[model samples]
Target: MAHGDITHIDIPVSDMARATAFYSGLFGWNIAEMPGFEGYPMWQAPNNISGGGLAPRDDGFEQPRSYVEVDSIDDTIVAAEAAGGSVARAKAPITETSAWAVIVDPDGNHIGLFEGVVGG
Candidate 1:
């Protein structure tokens, strides 16, 4: 995917089992915890392409966050800042080569920026 494309979404939930069962049953979504990620249960829509994780809801993270695939996190941060948005979270590495960050738009909406796959 290219920059600005929405690659994933992170849904914050207070009750993991309840939320997982509800979504999976309501939308026919496949939800399960993946290896290496014990607590975060990932969910995929029926289309098989659309998916994200059901993360534990925490302070300052009460809303569902959409992750956009960016060409570069550093560049995205610069552009977001220039465009009146501010970095809510600094770039955090998913692996040695890939990272993710979150920014708050002018209106205070949280948006996630993902830089490629885990090994990319």
Candidate 2:
């Protein structure tokens, strides 16, 4: 994804099986667990252009979190802070060429930021 694109959306769930069945049944999404990402099942929309993971619910992740593609995590973090948002999570490595982080908006919404091919 290019800058400003919502790369992925993570929907927090309490019961994996129930949530998976509900979403897959209602949305006709292809939900399945990947090899490396077992407990968290991934769902792909029928269009194949939209997809995200059903994450296990946890503190600060009780609601759906959308990850946006950014040009640089460092710059975004700084910009977010300057814009009244605060860093919820510092930049973390996803792979050799990719990274991700989270920021809390003024309204307390936690949005994710990703850079590179992690969401591709």
Q: What's each prediction's TM-score?
A: 0.94, 0.93
> Model 2, 96: alpha-carbon shift in Å?
2.5
Show model 2 residue runs off by greater than 4 Å: none
Tens-digit per-residue lDDT, 10-79, candidate 2: 9999999999999999999999998767798999999998999999999878989999999999999999
TM-score result, candidate 1:
0.94
- The per-model lDDT (C-alpha) reads 0.91, 0.92
Question: Candidate 1: worst 10 consecutive residues by lDDT?
Answer: 111-120
lDDT of 1 by residue, 30-92 (tens): 999987678999999999999999999999789899999998989989988999999999999
**Candidate 1: residue 99 Cα off by (Å):** 0.9
Shift in Å, residue 83, candidate 1: 1.2
